[model samples]
Target: MKIIVFLGPSLPRSEAASIIDAEFRSPVAQGDVYEATLIRPDAIAIIDGYFGFQPAVWHKEILWAMTQGIHVFGAASMGAWRAVELGPFGMVGHGWIYEAYRDGRLEGEDEVAITHGPAAVGYKPISEALVNMRRTFASAADAGVMTVDTARQLVQIAKRQFFPKRDYEAVITAAQLPAAQAADLSHWIRRHAIDQKRRDASSLLHWFSQNINYLSAPKRVAYQFSATVFWAQAVELKRREMLSRYPGRKLDHARIEQFTRQTMGNADVQCRQQRLEQCKP
Candidate 1:
């Protein structure tokens, strides 16, 4: 069975591959899944994705993949968020993080967002995920590493920081815990911190591996995909990008512009042209 997994900082590629043998790609961005559908893999598992710095994978593309009979599974970071939003539409969600979002216990992307290094460094995390910090604080409180009040204070501090700057050291410093207690909590965290994202990501990979046989069969969905003008534009952009990769493949720009105008209507076309002109220096 052919399966593709979009993965990144939530878990290392080597660790995930050890759990499930599949074609693993870097964190998914806009149009990535749509491009994957061209390959018609039996199933696709989304564990991590790009946002903020890049366009995120679109829900329309995922629905389109399902309409094409490809099974879609989501969990961990971006996957968990998309799964909760698209579950009723046929996307299968797995792991505790997915459940947390589905049940409304978690409501924001900040819970999963973490700053990380480039893919060349295996997307090394430079900041802690709020979800992991929450879990770790709770665990520390249960283990008597800190008081329940202290744990709650830490959570609040972590939540207030922007995701890119959220980390244990910052939270602990902001909380102003006693020096000895701070040292003890830090030591405990280094030893027993719960990496909820990685755990959920691994669960997703394992679940996909176990169900590969069943997933090999075509997926059936109850909804029909509607290709709106935006989706068409995305498709056209992808086509042009693919064509640009080959030499001597001349593009008919005028024809493409005509098609765009027809799909987007003259008013929208004019608005886009005005915006383009405004950007000129």
Candidate 2:
């Protein structure tokens, strides 16, 4: 059985698949985790997910997946978001992004959120993530491309822009350092705009490959999962989606056609019989 990975922008399908031989699915949305658990995969790694307009994946779904004997792991992007909240409950969190969230050093969903292109383009990122910004600036300071204070200023410049419109060029321009300093910082950023999300995602993938057998281990949650009204409602929605999609139920076109004809014929006979009885004198 394949390990299921809920992935998107952070790690491209081709690159991530090469790192770990697992099924790569698109970013998790509202009901994705609950729906994925129906297959009972050995493990799941959530690396990226949807937000805004569409409903984001629920924390309860990740917990539910863990309770069903599946190893649930998360990192980078939305994965980092979920893992922080659910890590104490057996959801594995990986990478610096997750560490930041867990330690309360990095707070806020926007830190990881970035606007990107569609899947056809491999979710080509159009905006910079705050996580990447922090990494880039830290590296800049450490590398002497900028002073510690300068790096902090550039990071703040990035924070001022909306997440969707954020980019290295725009942020650097906003920094307004001296001409020589700006030139050095610009060259450094161009060469080293580390994509922290992708890096963290890769780390989780490596971890997933090394710990394949961990799926069988029992979790020690502080409490058991109760089917609260909210949880039940979410499950109901997932069930409806599953049923509507006709999962595992297949009828060939000819068989469906025959069934439809037989149904119509039965209706025709019933209608005629009723008319005949009504007209009887």
- Measured against the true structure, the TM-scores of the candidates, in listed sequence, are 0.87, 0.83
lDDT of 2: 0.79
**What C-alpha lDDT do the candidate models reach, one value each?**
0.86, 0.79
Best by lDDT: 1
Itemize residue pairs with steric clashes in candidate 1: none
Give candidate 1 misplaced runs (Cα > 4 Å): 245-281
Candidate 2 lDDT over 149-247, as tens digits, reads 888887788887899999888887787777888788778888888999999999989887787676556544565665444554455455556667886
Question: Which ranges in model 2 have alpha carbons more than 4 Å from their true place?
Answer: 218-222, 243-281
Model 2: lDDT of residue 57: 95
Where does candidate 1 have its weakest 10-residue lDDT segment?
272-281
Model 1: per-residue lDDT, tens digit, 1-281?
88999999999999998998799998999888977876778998999999988989999889888987999999999999999999999999999999999999888999999989998999999999999999999999999999898998999999999999999999999988889999999999999999999999998888776766778679899986654546556766666676776657765556556544444555556555564334222
